[model samples]
Target: MNAELEARRVERESSRVISAHARSWQLVSALRVEDFDVAHLGRADQVILDMEDAIDDRLKQQARDHVLEWFAGGGKAWVRVNDVTTPFWSDDLSALAGSPGVLGVMLAKTESAEQVSVTHHRLGGHVPVIPLVESALGIEEATSIARAPGAHRLAFGSGDYRKDTGTANEAVAMAYPRTRLVLASRIGGLTGPIDGPTVGSVHSLLREQSEDAVVLGMTGKLCLDHEQPAVINEEFSPSPADVAWAVDFLEKFEAGGRVIRDGSDKPRLARAELITRRASYFHVDPR
Candidate 1:
């Protein structure tokens, strides 16, 4: 059984290749073991096994056991563990230490650099740890948190953030926190931050929310449902028009000896270069 589990673990690790530019991050409740299957993950670029916020206190152990079983059975995913201040955090770390199929961990309710450093250490200091900044304090400490050891990237816990600050869920109301996270990630030399999930069945609304996040420099989004990934992915990715414009601009600039005509030329060149690179990364061909 041990050898078979190891084989499965190796196979699982080898087969699942998640991109750093993955836009759709779907979170599945650890309590719902059935949802861990590939079929249920839909088009999500990545999946997170949520052990915090989704499970009740009484079922924490059961949830942990289920996640371990899934990993043992060849499931691969990032796990959203409880906050550092919680009793569940220690047990969560212990259960996940040396576990196969753990892509990384998302530390919930992270408000300080110490929490991120401790979680990273507990996870053996190699696995990526994304801190979910969810409160005023976390937002205030955003840069420090992003600079913490093992901080791969930051994610916004928008719902909890709104609740914490009595702010509305509107894009205008949420922009400050989202912008803070984006700036912090950049300053910390990390990739763009992941925006929080949208909570609704409406595809148009999801796209709009995803677009808002994208405009605020969030390259990825946490999604709540299987159907939401496609929308988030589409919205977050560079559009065909953008690719076409980038291709045209680069060709013209190269043909013109790459001369900067004015102040606007520099920013335009930067934008064009960025778009083409992102297009290539996302496998989007110029139209």
Candidate 2:
């Protein structure tokens, strides 16, 4: 990275951070041609017109044309194209380039910061990108990818990753990768990375995973089921009850309660502030 390019990278990274803070979206729902209309009913924070995993290889061209029609008609959404190395990638890019409907591109199986730059250049304009990092190598380079010039943020492809690493999809099995992406986003000054989905519409499991993401400092999640969005949004956000608790704790701490004024006062204050900050995302006007 030359000085000029480094400067440009910094500028774009700043844009990404600003863009993330200004956006209140929390859930990303993947959709195919069959589900396009339902997706527009607004059940999700963002819709990914999936051309990679969701569609069969034989139907790739059909999916591309359908998506192109949707774009040309002025509909807007992110398109999750195949990886850069695949044949489908160029075709997906060709269909997506310069379309007003493209909110951004979600580059599937993103492994390197350089790959993000290539996707950005090929897009022919300054479209924000969310790189879906899945492989072990991708997770290792997560910080670089998160800070890459065109990347808006990162998304963990948990299922594929589990397959790659031969690990179960259990939370403990997936913890390192999840934590890596989340910390990388924070380090890069981007909004928290989007965590992967919980399958089978299991509300209990969904809530558990979503809460885990929140505890790990992630605010957004990729949702497969439509109902998963509400769960993700709720779990990531500090509810009114949480706000109340934070306020009461702060007040008592200010009044010098021994427990509140204990050695942990500083961390308590920071926690309260973080609770309020998370609450603010949902327009939670504190009373």
Candidate 3:
């Protein structure tokens, strides 16, 4: 019975490794684009528009226009709209929903799933909604928020979250929140959560910050500048070494039939962990 069970596990692991390899290849082969060059970035798989303080109708319209152009150029564009509770909520949604280029709307300061649902109803289901959790309340309500209709992804709002929690802008301080968002996103069956941008100066610091976020299970990092998208892409996208290791690990596990030791370690690798590792390769760095 034990041997039979081990065979099943091995089979499952092999299948997982194949899937991971295919996914990794897709991610590495995928195109990437920068922020300001929305038209150029539109060629990539995803684009993010940060509309933090553009409250006026004109600026909002301009933002919507740029996003629409990006979509027209054949890229998936997601706009980070102002907080729903703010005065700009109605205008932002109304403007974006009417734009043909906007594929998704990311709601900032989302405290509950109800907020997402409300926004979806207001937009009349034109685009998917991603909830950005930036406060203690948002973190606590993450699960419900992820389950909300139109909620396709969960994002961490690092700067606002740090200010709200009074936590230092360091990896240790942000770890808990990052993990919580990842857990909630997974439970709610949303796309894996994206880590907040590193509000630092040095390139090395930013790289380290992104690595830390990756360790905490974030699939991607947010960016404010175009240069940042490249930096982010380098970090989130797995290196050639990572691909080699995953491939080798799976090969060894498969050879052993029912039970395999990973690099002499007694325990076998979990299927989920293997998938996560493979998924990491596809995560583009938004430098």
For residues 256-283, could you state the per-residue lDDT of candidate 2 as single tens digits? 7764546787887888988877666565
TM-score for each model: 0.92, 0.83, 0.73
lDDT by candidate, in order shown: 0.88, 0.76, 0.65
**How many clashing pairs in candidate 1?**
0
Q: Residue 94 of candidate 3: its Cα lDDT? A: 73
> In terms of TM-score, which candidate is stronger, 2 or 3?
2
Candidate 3's residue-wise lDDT over 95-159, tens digit each? 76666666577788999888999898888875788788999999989989989998877888888
Off by over 4 Å in 1: 1-19, 39-41, 257-259
Point out the higher-scoring one by TM-score: 1 or 3: 1
Residues 1-287, candidate 1: write the lDDT tens digits.
Answer: 36765575565545332546778899999998878875233578788999999688999999999999988876778999999999999999999999988989999999999999999999899989999999999999999999999999899999999999999989999899999999999999988999999998999889889989999999999998888988887898899999998888888888986556888988889989988877776688877
Worst 10 residues of 1 by lDDT: 10-19
TM-score top scorer: 1
Which run of 10 residues does model 3 get worst, by summed lDDT?
21-30
**Local lDDT at 114 for model 2:** 92
**TM-score, model 3 to reference:** 0.73
Using lDDT, rank the candidates from best to worst: 1, 2, 3
Q: List the residue pairs that clash in candidate 3.
A: 227-287, 228-286, 228-287, 229-286, 229-287, 230-287, 231-287, 232-285, 233-285
